[model samples]
Target: MNAAQLRAAARARAQRWLRDRGYLVERLTPDELRYMTSWSDAPIPAGQPVPQRDDPRLVALRRRYDELDWPVTAHSRWSDRSFVDFARFRGDSLYIWHYRESPRVSALKYFMFLRYVEERDHKGWLDALGEDGAFGCWTFEFPGRRPVSRDLLDSVNELTFLDRHLQLSGWDGLRALDIGAGYGRLAHRAAQALPGLRDWCCADAVAESTYLCEHYLQYRGVVPPARVVELPDVPSLAPGAFDLAVNAHVFSECPREAVRWWAEQLARLGVNWLFVVPNEADGFFTHEADGSRRDYREVLEQGGYRLVVDEPAFADPAVRELLRVHDRHCLFERDRP
Candidate 1:
């Protein structure tokens, strides 16, 4: 066979191999092929291996988590039985920090970081908090900046966004509550960022989350300002104690009932302001583990919170599109009294 015929035969075989593996094969132009090849060759950093299930600490936390009477939706995605990877909480299990270490993803995150720095100009402030890559987190070094991980970038961005909306920087003796406070990521950052922050309560329905939050905040040496409030203990919090409440990428993962329960609790606590970062960009929806969605905005509204601010996670449209980040920063205020 001639050279062109041999090339066609090789392409056919490649397409067939892909088809057998359930991938739809398509003809790729030179540029597309190069992009695909680069992505395939991207280096994925090694993460901490999952710890043994029977680790005494994990066993204790799991027992505590199982003891709670969680709302059906609350346990959907965060239960002990289904979510057994909590041991890698700091690495990639709970809050994602490792997967973005690949070349393409890291570059996009760096650009997003640049956009955040340009808009907020809080790079120095964030750098001060430091990124030591504790507990097997993935860290990346950007030019002219201190080492950083998704934890640092995301926490600083969210905190700066909250400061912009709520004036957290100027609020003296500001008390805040974190709903679904996984490993106290925001709590530690907020405690460091807001010296005037009187009390930062980290609350989570997942027992393992509560366990990790307590340990993580203490490890970061923010225990005096940051404390973990178990789901059951949340009801004991005094009303009007917290000036603001923050939920990052949490409501979208909860069930409708769980969302309602949290809204009710926040209302009962008389938290004046609520800042939520939903996984959805255009609408308020709950993402159930069973692959279902339900509108949760009405639940919060019925609980007396009114939507006041709804903006893209990244203020710049170009940055948003380039990073493919559709998350939104939503701020709500209590409607009554």
Candidate 2:
């Protein structure tokens, strides 16, 4: 097929896939497509506004997460209410604020993560992870509640390309670390591919995610050698620990100071490669000075990291419903020593 034909085919396929999944897909201007809130009980609108029953998965999640008795709180288990919960709670308002503007994306992302968590638990990954594991998100305590079909697909594609790119670049034995290891989904996938990693740690500033990882490891019956740490002013990681440090779509929402602090921490961690996945042309945080968005590259570089790999975006089946339209690209090795 010619370029135009190919593009047309992809668009058709995308629209069909979205419709099959109950999204109302429409082509707006050539550059953008707007997915408004659907009145339908769909966690996200399949199209613009309409009425439908709430999704069963969403109902289950709300029943579980919204309950005051579900689990941890300031008054609940101290260990349960760890730094992870604190951070998430702190971010909850911010996230909610953003959700008003992009409820569909937020809701879908949350739903997919929960789904993945539930699936992993059903697979016994959670039991294998042991008692140390706990859930990370403020919305739901399980990964299964979050919908991530497009995100995962996009992640897999990005990883596939990254593997090839790194292979061509003589990148081998590259030890790595992941901050904000939400439910350990992305890190788990990366571990499956990057065999050369000598030392790798999946970390989150929050204890909840670490706890969840432990649970997930149990469910999967896999013993993890690395443990999660409290995200410090500087991470208490071993010096020269990894060749790569990655945060997928993590830094974008983080405060500027936090981003700078983490970048410096990564530099101290001795990683030569830094990878970040964010929306291609936009970020979560906004600026009042010029009503502009944060620049990923600029902030990281200012904090002492360099971009080594910048690749175009690809669609992920998990998030295809949410992000198939925009330029949601992934960047690898964004920060280099």
Candidate 3:
């Protein structure tokens, strides 16, 4: 089935599952629907997107998130549930940042996020700098209750640009290095996408994430011991190790100085293509509070890399919703600069 069909099928299944569990499903209006669309669907909302304190629903959701550790299955994906879960994992320390202080638009946001996850079929985040103060201290959790890798692999194909580049530029035959490959979602999908890709490495600074990847690989029974790396050897690693390097959610959450260092290392890796991901508006917080969001244009420019093409946001419905909630990933490539 096509992306739209797959999305509809997944939504139907999810809605049915939610209904069976006694959750009400509300049909979204056009405006509400738009909000759940990809970040590129609409222009970035004007200043201070945070809901007002007087807003009862927003206030209630925020209060619940702040006070209670709610069940992940109970709340909507977009609802305060995500924020609460995130806050639980990350701690309330980020609340000190005024922009992140806003109550999450839980219900709407969760719908978008889950859809994106389903569509994209993977949750990609950058590897932290092995520092406690980075990336909100959110632990990587893979809901690997079942074999969902195929579902995610199909979802990533919605990006015409990425698919095209892989086919046209011979990325199909290369080895892949997924930096900060949270839960091996992207790495798994990449493997599924390109049959000729013989070797794949899912590297992250966290041992927990690597463990999850190993588990996933074991479950799939592809590689006896899949390349799940947990080390700080990006800088001095063997040269030309992988043909493609994907840094999802890595540049933004890592320390600013570290981002530059990683960039240089990636450059030296001599990879044919590099994918640097960051969220749309709330990358390092809701409003650039931590300055984690790297300027892709600047980073590439300074690294002396040429931009082949850029995908503003994903077009897959499910992928788009994911963008709304967690990230708005864009792809950049440089070949033989």
Candidate 4:
């Protein structure tokens, strides 16, 4: 058979195999196929081992976390097993990239995202918040910039997007609450980027996350403006204390009940705006520990929040597809009583 005939035969066989396995095969253009396969050649980094010496602070934090009687939903994937290494909490544990993502690919995504920001960063926030590989985070140096990480790029992208919607630049005395604030990544960035930000409170149901957030914000020396609110203390926050609430890649990791609980808190606190970055591209869904997905949008709405904006994390569809980053940035406003 000619080469073309042989290729056809192989395609047929592959399709047959997929069908037998209860999979649907879709045809793709060469460019589309190239985009999908481009990451295959990217190199994966070696895994770093957890340090032997445990910090006494982390141990105390863990004790505090263990003492609390958390609901089952709050004890999902993050608390189920040792997902984070306290010693290297900022590395791959919080905002993980090394395990399921390629370093080179992630760098490309960050570079593209930087380009996107450069066009809109009239205030030079990106330059102000340039990243260093502090706390063992993975870093890549993009062109004309210092070392950058997913934590930095994602935080800046989110901030810029939020600014566009909420005019955050002009909002003086803005108080923000971060739910599932892992390692205080966004909290640190938001504090630096928005000088008018009165306070940025980092809260998390996971004890390790709270511990790291508390340590990281102080380690970065933004503790006055940015503070970690332990799970127990979150309820005590007075109504209307915060103007905005952000939950990035957080609700998706939580169970439905946990999402509902958080939504209720936001409603009770009278937070006017909510920002969520779900893992899904098109829907608001929760990722359960048992590898199941449940819709959490209704839970938020039940708590009197309504979706105001839903946009792709990467505005350019081509860039989003090429980078394989399809997260959606969702903003919602709480309905007044």
lDDT of each: 0.76, 0.46, 0.46, 0.77
Give one digit per residue, the lDDT tens place, for model 2 in 314-336: 33454444434343444434334
- Runs off by more than 4 Å, candidate 1: 1-61, 70-74, 80-87, 97-105
Q: Quick one: ranking by TM-score, best first?
A: 1, 4, 2, 3
Query: What is the C-alpha lDDT profile of model 3 across 1-337, one tens digit per residue?
Result: 9999999999999999999999968777776564344221223234413222344544443344345332211222122223322212222221111111112353334334334444443323111111122212212223432222212322353223455555522444567777766555555545544556667787754433444455455544546224665444455577788777777655554444444555676778877677655545332321123432345457555665666554545555554554343344455565463
Error of 4 at 224 (Å): 1.0
TM-score between candidate 1 and the true structure? 0.80
> How do the predictions measure up, each by TM-score?
0.80, 0.49, 0.49, 0.80
Residue-pair clash count for candidate 2: 61
Q: Write the per-residue lDDT of candidate 1 for residues 1-337, one digit (tens) a residue.
A: 9999999999999989999999976766774455444312223236633345465775676576567675733555564445534444566554553444445566667766655754684535666787777765656676886777778878887877887777788889999899989888889988888878899999887766777777678767898789987666678899989989999988888888899989899899988899999988888998776869999999999999999999887888887776777788899999976
Candidate with the larger lDDT of 1 and 4: 4
For residues 1-337, write the lDDT of model 4, one tens digit per residue: 9999999999999999999999978886774554344422222335533333266766776677777765523555565545565555556553655322434555666677668767777778777888766656656665577766677778877888988899897889999999989888898998888889899999888766777787778878898789988777777999979999999988888888888888888888999999999888888888676778899999999999999899998888887887787888899988886
RMSD of 2: 15.5
List the lowest-lDDT window of 10 residues for candidate 2: 70-79
Off by over 4 Å in 2: 1-152, 168-172, 225-227, 232-234, 280-293, 315-337
